[model samples]
Target: MSTETPAVRVTDLTVAYGELPVLWDIDMDVPAGKLMAIMGPNGAGKTTLIKAILGLVPPAAGRVEIHGGLYRDQRHLVGYVPQRGSVDWDFPTTVLDVVMMGRYGALGWFKRPGKRERDQALTALDKVGMADFRARQISQLSGGQQQRVFLARALVQDAQVYFMDEPFQGVDARTELAIVDLLKELRTLGRTVIVVHHDLQTVRDYFDWITLLNVRRIAGGPVDEVFTSENLKLAYGGRVEFLQRQAPCDPPPDAPDLGSYPGRIRP
Candidate 1:
């Protein structure tokens, strides 16, 4: 096993809303510089897991560590992209303003972002192919464009690890390709990324590692090792017979569809 410390670690993590248990004794370790995905059926605590790790939701149990430190102490090393639908798109804000928000963790709230921050935001927007829209209203952008902008925001953070919640949802195929390419580039820079993903067809193609969850971790590790027919059966039960047909153990050149969960980030 690689001896390097994991970029993120979760131990006995459990979360809840009042009494409704969401996660259960979850333990995960994401190696540095790896691209990983978290997958599960809808409302299966997939998003909750990310929230708990980010400290957006209080964990009922267990602890999260980033590079061997608590989340509160490692906030500067992390970035997050929430689900697109969760944000109010109609809010009045410029694209550049959105991207600059990423830098706020490093720059205290009392300090305003200056020219250096503006240039960095532009660079990030350019990286995601949205430089020209810097002055545009955030609400005027297409779903894909907005997603790219959020990714640019995350990139500007220069974080070692990033967590994204369902970034591919409703995005155009071209945007999906762009996002995947950007994620690959992040990996090349020795950054670790944990994505809340759903498409089974793209699991092997888009991520080297994966965690399957159904309110609890069914399996997690290298995609080839844990993304199996048996694990799919366990996590999704009878709901995923359409997926277990292949179950993505051995990758194929073509990506097969998995029920209502459609769309793939082609390699």
Candidate 2:
């Protein structure tokens, strides 16, 4: 494992909307080349955390660093995928046009995209299996297809670190699987991928690193180390009954054996 600086770092971070605090003293470090999941219940500031790290929303207090430097110094190295619901689907833009927007950061102020940029966009579309839909209007695509286009846009950015806010929302099972596969592929290519994930059942299956949040940092580390029942209770509170249902244990020895009961039938 590389002992170098983390791909993304946050320290003493605090965010508030008016006088209402959303995040408090948040601190996290995401290692390079790993797939990480930021998990919390609704209104736990998961989206706010990503926005603060990306400098989209100013932090009321604390610092955010990307690859050991300020976010402004490394803006081009970051890719962001906002929530699917955050965008206007009625926009009259083609899929290719949307993906090309990713190159705008590198194009600087107002330069038009050239052949090189087009080719890059096409390649990114292919990466996410959306090459055929390049000419389709954004509003015409299904929910999953639209998500893939946004992902393709991010891919064309060629960022070193990627932040996605609920990319799986409203997506089909196939699209969800595809997104997870793509995240793993990015990790193989040495890029860091962070996702705001809500499903607890898939946390162990999808992420190598996880940070539990509930207005504050509850736990963070490798999945095996930090994704414990105790930490889960702290992060999710009373909603942990699902874990109990999935847990395995023997019934009480004095309990009647269902197998011997006339009402009970074997499968």
Clashes of each: 0, 0
Cα-based lDDT at residue 62, candidate 1: 97
Error of model 2, residue 252, in angstroms: 18
Task: Tell me the spans in candidate 2 whose CA falls farther than 4 Å from its real position.
Answer: 1-3, 244-267
Tens-digit lDDT string for candidate 2 (179-200)? 9999999999999999999776
TM-score of 2: 0.90
Can you tell me which runs of candidate 1 are displaced by over 4 Å? 239-267
The candidate 1 region of ten consecutive residues with least summed lDDT is 258-267
Best by lDDT: 1
Computed on alpha carbons, the lDDT of every model, listed in order, comes to 0.88, 0.87
Question: How does candidate 1 score on lDDT?
Answer: 0.88
Worst 10 residues of 2 by lDDT: 258-267
